[model samples]
Target: MSLIARTGPQEYECRVGVLDSLTEKLRVRGITKVLIIHGTDSWDKAKNYLTQLMDSDITLEFALFNGECTHEEVDRIVGLISQTQAEAVIGVGGGKLMDAVKFAADKSSGVESVLIPTLASNCAPWTPLSVMYTAEGVCLGFVIHTKQVNLLVIEPNLLLDAPVDYFVAGIADTLAKWYESDVVLSRPEYQTNALLLLSRAAALNCRDSIVNYGLQAVKDIQNQTLTPAFIQVSETIIAVSGLVGGLGDGYSRSTVAHAVHDKLTAFPETHTFLHGEKVGYGIMVQLAIEENWAEIDRLAVFYESLNLPKTLADLNLSDLTEEQLGEVAAKVAVDPILLQSQYRVSKEVIQGGMRSLENYLATTV
Candidate 1:
């Protein structure tokens, strides 16, 4: 038996003016009627690039993505798809919008999905999974779907206008591909698994590309410039990062870093933090658990340069009660995703990791 990797969408394209072909592309796929689910702000920005879809004879029904990939949102999208008899569903926005459409389309008898990401925030546009959340924005894990997206097209112009904070958060999120996967992939037993090896290579690319070009990419986004570094970093975040989990499956899927992020979401104070920002802090915690101080030191410099969260204070958890901190550590210690790594961490160890990271950061200063 061989490993089956759902690496990305069936048809993926990234370039300037790509959405200009949106109508013809859908038409060729036998998709005439579509339910376009989008965020208010992102859809407004994406509208300029989708002139073809608007002018074409295709029947279009528009629905607003309610800012979360909650079950209610997915159900609403699915209901719209059924009522409109849409042949396809197009998602135009950030990760949550795309995830809602993807999951809704799958539930709606596997209707074709076309994703247009307005923000280079995460791999939701590329991966065959949806990171589900509550209506209140708490993490509820994720669900891997049976079908891949029918099409995913990225227009650099649209992403160039995205908020720089999301771009930086995307970089931090993409960097986790390396930190999360290497823990398990570097083991001896999986040495000969070719697909996992490919995943390992992709994970390394995600790390190196982001580290080398992330700052410049942030600057490019800030200046609204479509430079080579911007394109490379954006694609690395959206496409290359997908390969880490797609190719390796559970082995390279989120480990401790993401589990930490998930746990932190339970705190209301951390609600203001972006997904990747918390994961950035989680990376330091994961390193502390492994007692890998050298790598932690290396990453701390990068974290500081990007204004990524490296300590509890950075995540606004500096004043968290001892009981509250213990609760978080206990929850994270038992997270199912944490088992993916070779580590066997306990609640005390998790708490110690947090303290060690804070102590280490203090020493660095």
Candidate 2:
């Protein structure tokens, strides 16, 4: 029998003022010299908290991320680690920077890594995978590492400073965990799988938590108050959402939703939209493909409240001709991940779903 790897972060802490304890956390793990990879803007905001670490005995170095998590960037960071002889890497920024640091640390043998998300954008910090993109910002693929993060520190205070849009996008992305995974796990063949059972519970938690508390969470984020609702929703996004993928393994991996997001990346016009925004629309498309109109209507209402993308126009693909959409459909249909769905998907089906979603949106509006 093949061995299944069920691993998560060695240590996970979510609380206010957790950033102050970062250096000591590393020290306890015997991590001495550390390389910190962060975004320019995020670093500017976090410098004050980071200053506290300098007082500790741990040696530190800094690397500025260029906004894309490409293989080249990972290699460059790995090179820096080699030269500096950094024992560990601390990623203190958003999803892209965290992914870059994670990939680099995984590639560099014997080096451990920690993630401190400056924005609750995606579950890049907790998962053992990096969503790779081209330098030009096109989605290439994702790389699965052999291990989960060494530590995940989520300081609610730090997250509160992030733009409200990031939190909304995160909600949309986390919600996809349920819509995307539920269809596959509901299949009879996989019902007995223990991992899928755990994954289903996690996915449900993501959906329910967001549905019950997401609106209030967004409000709290706008007010810069870390209320109970906000904390619950944020953890649902970062921690519980990661568990959906971690426990489910390949069976619960994203299906049509992420496939559409990947194909949408090929268009520069769609670049302005966040990852979750595109996936939010992709969820509608997936529902359309399944002929689940009621669920689509329910989600459309929720997405409208959150300002998530609901139509091609919302994704900045309003002017796209049928031929252009067909090109995107072709890509999505061919993606290997789409096959993970319990039902077969085709280019024609994707195109039809796009039309159906557009029609539904038109009538509703």
Candidate 3:
């Protein structure tokens, strides 16, 4: 049998003030000598919550990163962990910081880490994979070091301070979970209870929050009010995106959506667009290719109405030539997941979809 079964730990605690009981949990798991990995943010906003969790004897160290998870940042964090002989890592910040901890802790002498998410941007906390980058912003490998997560500590009050755009993008990312998964999981060899559970949940709730909340979710962000819909979106990103998306056993996400995003990223003009925004557009493009016209048009209105990028210009890439898009398509061709998985996704087909998306976006606005 595999060393780590594709299952969560026997016990998990997803709660507010998770840190108040954290010391006991760590002691229960035999974890000591914790490292706090932080990103650039307002510590004051979360100071009280963290202070309550700190035990008198727990040795703490700070490993800092600016906004990005660069190679240098990882090195600094890892260097600190290596020098300190810490037993576990506690990542505190938004998704990027959590992702960095996930990447570094596994490589730091096999120490497990706890993810304390301060914002519900994406489900980076729940996943075993870390999306890493070079110092120069080149996309590197999706670091899949540890298949285990020790804890996910979330306090809704802490999230009330977050910028609503993070939550909005998070919802967009989760929406793709169901749509992309539906295509990928249909492959006979890879479908499973876990994948079905995740994809179905994601699909069902894709539009529910927005439909129910309307502009209230956005207003909640403006007012810093944690509405019921906001909580659902946050939970989806932190819980479903990380755990469910990570545990999609043998399932493929190499669908038309992500492929189109990959191709779009080839051009520098589209670089400023947020990850979720790109994926949202990608999902629309994928639906168009799959000829799910009903869903595609509906999604198009939502994406456009929200001032999200529907065409290249919206991504600030109105001037990109077709050659740049082709280059992106070629670069996307390199991911091994495209060919090695149970589902068959052709490079040519993906390129065609990208071209179709580009054409559609050109005419969309």
Candidate 4:
């Protein structure tokens, strides 16, 4: 048995106005020169929170994140760090920007990294891995960094004005923790492992907390209200969901649900969909593969309420030709995460699961 769990950042703080301490944190660490990489719009949202840091004596270099966390983007940020001789890099945006900064910092020898997420889109701020994609937005898997984030500061006030769709997508992505981890953790062999048990508990907490608070949190963001439910759901998404993979290691990291996501990303028509929206549909596909129609029915109601994708039509892939659909199935059939789960499935099995899920939905509608 092998276990590799990179729990989270060395230091994490989530509260309103917590960013006031950032400059001092850096000063004490002796990080005099820093690189600030941010998204265009995200910078506008987050800049006001960093007034103190901007006024500090520490030297700063700024770079606009190029959107995708591609290898080229990592190389560019790495080059910027080298040229500027930045002692640390700070990412202020959504997941892509944070992932790119972490990857670049890892490649930059002794450079430290800090994250201040402007969007509650995913666990990118808490996790020590970066999900890489092509320039055109195709998924190219992810890389786990050896060095953890030096700090993660979540200014809930900054996220209050974030787009509602991204917040909803975050809920969908975080919910995948339970559905994905249970697929492997429920096995008899994993039942006795202490760490996996903790991972399982954390994953279950993600599901329960999201179910209990998700809708209210949605209303919270829609009205720009900072309520208790909103804070609860936000922490659940970024912190607790992170522990599913953090404690369970590779065993609960991902499975068929994420595999289905990788396959769907190959289609350009699906490019407009968010990561969690795609994974929401992948959950149904995974359930269909296991012939768990009941669970799919239950989740379909929740997914509909959240406006998450539930069908090929929802993903704009209903017009795909049989050959194209077959290609997706074939790719999913051999997905690394799927294979790693020890569940053998053929391309035909995947295609049938898709068809079955559609047929079931047709009956429900």
* TM-score per model over all chains: 0.97, 0.97, 0.86, 0.98
Worst 10 residues of 1 by lDDT: 335-344
Quick one: RMSD of model 1? 1.4
In candidate 2, which residue pairs clash?
A: none
What lDDT would each prediction earn against the true structure? 0.89, 0.87, 0.65, 0.90
**For candidate 2, which ten residues in a row score worst on lDDT?**
1-10
* Model 3 lDDT, residue 335, Cα: 58
lDDT of 4 by residue, 3-91 (tens): 88789999999998899999999998899999999998879879999999999999999999999999999999999999999999999
Candidate 1 positional error at 39, Å? 0.6
Report the C-alpha displacement of residue 169, candidate 1, in angstroms: 0.3
Number of the top TM-score candidate: 4
At residue 63, candidate 1 shows an lDDT of 83
lDDT of 2 by residue, 1-365 (tens): 12254456889999888889888898788998999888877778877777679788889898888899999999999999999999999898998888899899999999998988988878888889899999888998788898779999988888888989989999999999998899888888777878888998999999999999999999999998878898888888899999988888766768888999999999999898888888888989999989999998888889989999989999888999999889999899978676644446889999999998999889978
Question: Model 1, residue 338: displacement in angstroms?
Answer: 2.0
Error of 4 at 119 (Å): 1.0
Which stretches of model 4 miss by more than 4 angstroms?
none
**Candidate 1: where are CA atoms >4 Å away?**
1-4, 340-343
